[model samples]
Target chain A: MMKVVKRTYMGLIFLFLYAPIAVLIAFSFNSSKSRSQWGGFTFDWYLDMIGDRQIREALTFTIVIALLSTLISTLAGTVSAIGIHYMGRGVRTAVLNVNNLPVLNPDIITGVALMTLFISSGLPLGAVAMLIAHVVFSTPYVILSVLPKLRQMNRYTAEAAMDLGATPAMALRKVILPEISPGIISGALMAFTMSIDDFVISFFTAGTDATNLSILIYSMAKRGVKPSINALSTVMFVTVVILLFIINRKSEKGEELML
Target chain B: MRMLAWPYVAWMGLFVIIPLVLVLLYSFTSGDIHDMTTWRFTLDNFARFNEPIYIKVMADSFLLAVASTLICLVLGYPVAMIIARADLRYRNLLLMFFLVPIWMNFLLRTYAWMSLLSPNGLINRLLLSVGLPKLEIMPGQGAVLLGMVYNFLPFMVLPIYSVLSKIDRHLLEAASDLGANRFLTFWKVIFPLSIPGVISGITMVFMPAVSTFVISALLGGGKTPLIGDLIEQQFMSDRNWHFGSSLSIILMAVILLSMAVMSRIDANQPVEGRRAA
Candidate 1:
């Protein structure tokens, strides 16, 4: 009886989570334009998604921005994590607190603050502003991901490399880098996911010309979503599931990495 | 290694510190966008909250956030406990199930609810087929609350599960050995240990729910605007940056205060769950 109860509860929760997704996936093949009626199955929405120019542009921008921000933030965050690891306690504490601001603050505050900053600095709000906002928000998570690894490893490993007649850069590249590579990779993936999924910040920072898929979706949602959106989400959902499956498979400590 | 830290320092200063300071500056200033040169500092933006409408929205935001957090706690605790106690082979798969929806675009997820709850939506159709009335819940607070719970329940569950799974089995055994019933063991031994996870979960859910503009916009249909929508409207539609910044500052302060409280609870007893990221 207890086992049955548990199974039923789990089933219901899983249904709650997936029903929307199933609806989305099912609707992607929806032959009818109206959401209410399933006018037989058709691949037209998928084909239409392929042919939609605006969606294609938004898709390109989304991937490009996600890639760029992830690359930049990962490098900055990992390097900083190393640097902070070696810092005197006082300065390191202050810097870490500063780093925590974006992570801790609500996304709207971060979005609005960055938007205000972009305006004050006279930077035109567009892809560049959006990219900078992504980097600012993302780098902290990367730092956090890398910091624990740095704290766990022996501080002497990199120094040992230096003592063994290797140059500082060589020591870092071969020794320190390899040690924290898992953190770096997870951090990069996290940053990429965040950038791709971001909407509030992107909405504020992205100006007229340089909008991503999220911004595009928001606008389309406001004006009644196109069936193409269902197609788009279906593709995105599949992509993310595959990516997460691979990541989970690769990492034994997947739960902590996710945290 | 120490020298390598300078770029990070510089980046944080330029990007993180200065932008927040800019928000502070803007919150205290007044003027049109074009006439930034003559901007004068004033407390009027902060004072604007005295208006009944803004106060109502702010209260509504908190109310909704609290309600959703409570609901998530009620709903997620059992699920988390069940998953934690489940056989090891199925644990990862169960966790993965909860996580996959979060990976989908948040907007898309909310949009999914929109389709389900619309008058002509699937749920309504089901209701009509069952000889019941169509649900008018879509464009109301109930729908918004549902959306909030759906989106953030994972945030609540994951932390609690992480902590619960790590609970010392010996303690539970001891409680049962001491003649405590199953409920008593849970209450005395298990529940106390899960407080940290619960605290973090509350923070995770409440923080996002209180500040979400998208969910309220889509699910609430602009009929019920949360503090987030007010902030968004001020900046985006109304072009009132001063007011927006002030509201942002207020929201930030409230969220930070709650976090401080969580940290205090966490400090009193060191938590095994994920810390605030």
Candidate 2:
């Protein structure tokens, strides 16, 4: 009786989890784009997505920003994590807590405040402003992800490298980086996905012509619900699933790389 | 690591502190953009509190956030339990389900809902065809809550899942052997152990929902202006930074107070996990 109840509960939970995405995937493929009559199965939307010029551009921009933001923020967050990881536990915790302030603060605060600062400083909202805002948002997450690994690692290995006459930089490069590489990679992935996924903050910070995929989607929505966006969604959805599959497989292989 | 210290100091100062100080200053000083730098610190920005509308919006935003948090917690708890306790084979896929939506572009997900829920959209159309009541759901408070809940569900899930993975199964077995039934065993053994996750998830949902702009803007159909929407409009369109700053300051106070209350509750409960204590 208990087993039955537990199974039913778990089934309901899975249903809740997958229902929306299932609905989305189904609708994207539905032949009747007018409403969702399911007239027939059609791959026409996915084919149309291939030629959607604005969507292509938006995706290109989104990927570019994601990569750029991830790379820079990874560099910064890794540095911060290593720095705090080495500090006395008390001081490290304090600095780490302060670094997490951005997460606790609302995005409106971050968005409007950053926009105000940049505009006030006469800094045009271009690549620089958007990248800065992305980095700001991404850094804390990377730190949060990596800091646990830093905390858990046996530090004596790095100490041994240092005592064996390697410089601190060399020890980090030769030993520490290899050990913590998984955390760093996952952190970078988190940063990349998050930057691309970001909408509100990016919309506020981005100006004139420098819109990411998210903003492009919003702009499209404001204009009208184009059936083409369904095509675009189908494309993005497919790519995301493929990407998730690849990442999981890679992680499974433990493809550890330094830098 | 020592070398890293300098750059972090530089990074935090340039990006975090200066921007934060500027916002703080804006909150205190006069509101007009023309005299932004000059200060005759006035409470007038905060004085806008006399209007009941602003307060109403704040309360509504808070209520929506709280309700969403509650729903996510109740729903996420069991899903997280299964993900944590499942056979190792499908664990990755189940976890991927949680991560995929979160990692997917937020605008796409929100807009996808727009298409799904619109008056002439798929959902409404389906209901009409099935001879059910043709319900309007794409606009207003209901729509905003839907978007907020959809977007926020993962935030609640991730934290709870992380916590669940660390819970000891032996504890549950022990509770059952002590003569507690399955429900009582779960209630006494599992629930208390996961309070930290619940607290963190609450913070995650409440913080974002309290200030969600894009979801509210897209789904509210201009019927409601959330605190986030109001602050955003005040700064950009209204060009009333003074008023915006004051609103921001008040909102910040509310957020801090909410967090304080959450932490106090967390502290009051005797922590079951070593780390939580």
DockQ for each model: 0.79, 0.51
lDDT of 2 at A176: 83
Local accuracy of candidate 2 as per-residue lDDT tens digits, A110-150? 88778888887889986789899999989998888888898
Query: Highest DockQ: which candidate?
Result: 1
Cα deviation of B176 in candidate 2 (Å)? 2.1
Question: In candidate 2, what are the lDDT values of residues B125-169, reduced to their tens digit?
Answer: 779889998768668888888888888888898888888788877
Q: Which lDDT tens digits does candidate 1 get at residues A1-259? A: 9999999999999999999999989989989988777899999989999999999999999999999999999999998999999999999999999999889888899898888888878899999999999999999999999999998888887889889899999988998888889899999989998999999999989978888988888888778999999999999999989988887777647655776
Candidate 2 segments exceeding 4 Å error: A1-48, A88-91, A153-156, A249-259, B34-38, B271-277
What does the lDDT read for residue B202 in candidate 1? Answer: 95
Task: Mark the regions of model 1 whose C-alpha exceeds 4 Å error after superposition.
Answer: A249-259, B267-277
True contacts kept of 1: 0.87
Instruction: Please report, as a residue range, the 10-residue window in candidate 2 chain B with the lowest summed lDDT.
Output: B268-277
CA lDDT of each prediction against the hidden true structure: 0.90, 0.79
Q: What is the lDDT of residue A203 in candidate 2?
A: 80
